[model samples]
Target: MEKEDLKLLQQKVTKLRAEGKYKETIEACYHLLKSGKECNDFKSILTAHINHAASYYCIGDTEEAFNSIEAYVEVCSRFGDEADLLHQYNVLFLLYEYNKDFAKAKATLENCIGLGKKLEKYNIVSNGYSNISHVLMEEGNYGAALEAGQKGLEASKLHKPASPILELRVKLNIAKAYLELNHFHASKALINEMIHDPILESFIREKSQCYHLQGSWYRKQKIFKEAFDSLTVAKELVESYRDLYLLKSIQEERCQLCEQMEDVQLGYRVQKEYISLLNEINKQELALTALKLEIKHSMSDFKRKANTDFLTGIFNRSYLETTSKEWLEQASVKDENIVCILFDIDNFKIINDQYGHLFGDEVIKQVSNACSKTMKENELFARYGGDEFVVLVRGASLESGKKRAEEMRGIIGNVKIEMGGNSVSITSSMGVTDNLDGKVRSFQELFHHADLGLYEAKKSGKNNVCVKLADKE
Candidate 1:
């Protein structure tokens, strides 16, 4: 693709991903990757993988998102792109934290800070310290968390254009640390200032956190009425966004609502109501937990009807249309190397005429079985009409994807159906491509490019595998 073509694809995919269409975003990234003349050795590969990984992260595929990020890191490492490395290291730090690898998370953040210092990128340094505070907080080192957050704020002052979001994050971390250390006055000062800040209007979650912390401080000071007011606002704010975690925390605090009140009778009445509400909350939480467990088991049942093909009992065209982009996004989410493998039976029309429709049905079913045997457990495989099949392989690069396609072709060819006193052989032409290029907007477009490779495979004779990385033009 030309520079203008790549830019156009980027803009289109950006719009799609911004619209929360992660599947489309992943496909776009596949095109982006294809546009780069040499993704395994190119600078633009960074943007391609970043966009690709973010989509994967958004779609609950952390593994693939991280894989995408790892590739981004690998390319950056090769080019000595420290600035990009510094930022992506934060991403790696968070990934480690998400996986409860606090030791590695802290180390990654330290590395980020080191790169920031080397590059003199104060904003990166500030964010790195702020992240260190998060790890420290997780490790129950409140004093250290507070110190790191203060360092973050100090570094922020030097980062030009100023990041209010970063500043607010550091302050929130500091306030929490102070409260944990029983520095009531210090925590209160930060909370009071932030609670009324105009910036909080655009950051409701931060505002809610402020109110919740304020309520906790007031409650500790034996000021129940003020605590109640703050807690109520916090509850409203958290519930507005349906933030279950914050809501639950607020609810837990709200349960002791009437403590330290002068009016004993009124306090008792309010306490009783809160106790009842708490009881209801506990029951609801129990029900919610049970429902989640049940859904985990029944999810496949829900998907099978709409997604499965009746003939081969594999995924249908509809499934591919609905899920390719989603699978792409999911692949990108985990920073996973995602490969789209497109293939079709060689001389299928001739086979249909020679062996008749019944034999063709048998061939299709057997081919589907061969595909199932070739691919991994959770790979997305679907019949793309007639004899064409599409497999969205997550955690695989173009190289691995070709291997898988070849395996499938070989397996399908080895199968012979003896019918009408004759035996039949099957072969496949395949095309494989990756989404790391950061080009294209949907899986369809991504698949179409892979199809170009398939067309080449056909030209190279029946059973051939071809890959499309970037346009030779």
Candidate 2:
């Protein structure tokens, strides 16, 4: 293949892997390897091997993944890019960590950091420090993790354009280290700082880490309710992002929480769920190997269904929770505003009781459609629950959020669903909040305030929009 063609093909493999089509990605990589070999394209061939290894790892084929990585290393040793070598070493670190080879993982990360500094790739150096911290933490060396985390933070600051995500990640690792060391006050202070950080909100994986650490801190303090809530949010985020590795840790924490609460049945149920989730993840990974060899099933539908709500044909709560954080983070960095609007159908239960669920479903569909129509560009509308819907307006001011909420309320209130030769109209109550200034408030805090406003709206009268501002703290 030509050079441009080879580049496009490489991108295709990457895209496929990113989309979670591991089988398809592996197949593409195989084809690329064959083509590269025929064309004597050593670069393409080496890249194919690396891509194949990543895809294999994703599907739980550890042996093949390791073999491919080895092959990639050999190629890099002969004629590889310095940056590519750095990346491969990082990947090797993960592989070693997965196999419980903490010593090797730590060494590999150190090598990565050295190479990155030599090459002036400060980002890589920063990331290497972060990875080392994580490995050390896994090895039950909190002091070392804290040391590495601080180094990572300092290294990250050396870059021309600071990476908020990386900075937050290092801080979170340090916070975890603090928590593990039983430095409760120190950890709590750091956690509070990050929880309200707009920059941290963008990175869901790191945000989840923050929450997990917060849960740990709360648990240590004997604050059971706060601990459970934080852990639950962490669980939700990991599940949404499909971070199986992190999910396992969260599950273990939850099991502990259940035990501490003395809820044997709940503990049993949590343990069962953990097992089921693990099995499901393993099954999917194994299936990818089968798919590469035998089946060619498409996963697009499965992905769509996972992120979509069946009833309203809109984004589900999981999608909202995951994506909205990213949007908020971006808006924060740009010094723009993000408006969150929470609304639900008024007297939805009564409608269901009187008109039956079928009619109630129609009402929901109609209201959802109306609300969706009122959304502007870059806005997200999601079915929060049975009758609750949330609209996220990116780059919008507090006033704009309230205006949008009123517009949506009008749209929903005017919506009429024809049911059994009867015209039934329903109204909606809405709450709006925005992050305009630098005043820090977490997504949970924003949501809580909006919910309170919604309650106030409902109390005064339904079919109205209420505005709430973030407290100046």
On lDDT, the candidate that comes out on top is 2
Q: TM-score for every candidate vs. truth?
A: 0.56, 0.58
Clashes of each: 27, 0
User: Local distance difference test, per candidate?
Assistant: 0.78, 0.83
Candidate 1: residue 233 Cα off by (Å):
1.8
Over 291-374, each residue of candidate 2 has an lDDT whose tens digit, in order, gives 655522333454477679999999998788878777766666777778889999999999999989988888888888877776
Cα lDDT over the full model 1 = 0.78
Against the correct fold, how does model 2 do in TM-score? 0.58
Q: CA lDDT of 34 in candidate 1?
A: 53
Residue 424 lDDT in candidate 1? 73
